[model samples]
Target: MTELKQERAIRTRTRIIRAAAEEFDAHGFAGANVASIVERAGMTLGAMYFHFKSKEALAREVMNSQTEVIEPLLHSEGLQRLVDITLVWSYALRDDPLLRAGVRLAVEQGSFGLKDDSSFRRWERAMTECLEAAKKRGELLDEVEPALVAQFLVGACTGTQLDSQLSSGRSDLTERVVRMWRYLLPGIARRGAIAAIDLDPGRGRGA
Candidate 1:
């Protein structure tokens, strides 16, 4: 396609994804209607299908887009990044239904795919790489298994989102999320019941 055509296609695709996000966020994945999504996008059902094969595809698009929001928190921000990430996540759970929906979809992703896509795979790699970097920087225990720790961290975030949903009306939930981090993150990261880490990394994005 020509550059202009590619740009138009990209714009159309974004509109459809946005519409799908709103529908799915307001209504759970099972409840989201493709017709409604297309209408909201001001595109025909044909146009929607031309962009996305199914509602699941649209949800996947939203999930993929979320990496832009999360990758920074998961990588490169160091220990200080998680605090800000958690604070923002809690606020998102309270205010942005779309983010909560995205979280829900991510939690459910393992059950849906026959094979995890490259994007899904990257989440683990990103976490592993970051933890390895922290270890090299003397911020984490050298003995800690980076991959295991990464998955555990992801599970912790998922649990926090669940807490946010269960408490639906609470505002101070952010603090609770922060406190829960200690349990999952452990101020002293250890490896194989030995080599406990020291020092507070001063939580910011990644705990």
Candidate 2:
């Protein structure tokens, strides 16, 4: 009975989070309504409150849930892996409401008095790890710094996606990300490794 109850609770929480994500995606943090979220989830207020205490808590949860959709890529490594990660994320931004909501919330969090850069830091760390691997494999330029390149890549991606979102509602995000890599690779990747790196945005779809 306890196990069944726990499972039910998990499902309820997931439903609420999804609904909250949808609402926040459409309405931003200040505009989202808890009543509407409950209605969208088809759950009672008590059920939602049982999982998340307030709208702030729900927003934070939604922001943190962005990474839940990224699955590990198989047989990928080094510079190509980092490129694939960005491409995969670009695709995910178009398909996943949770990620979209999280991204919007992350950008707008400061307006709501929520100061958190953990998401950006997390992406920088992931990119840095891949860059470090690339460095070991001689794929990186001799003068390139993994941490600095990673930070710059994260900022570049963030700005690229935001522009794509503003112009085409992210319809052009993947293409923009491809363009971003095309411009970035020559600066950070070794001359010999440049041709070997795949810039196909679709390369990560199957990965």
Candidate with best lDDT:
2
Candidate 1, residues 130-206: lDDT per residue as tens digits? 66666665566556677887676666666766766667654556667666655655543544312332223333323
TM-score of every prediction relative to native: 0.74, 0.87
Cα-based lDDT at residue 176, candidate 1: 70
Model 1, stretches more than 4 Å misplaced?
71-76, 82-84, 108-122, 169-172, 184-207
Q: Give lDDT per model, in order.
A: 0.63, 0.87
Q: Report the lDDT tens digits of candidate 2 across residue range 57-94.
A: 99989987775566464348999888888888898888
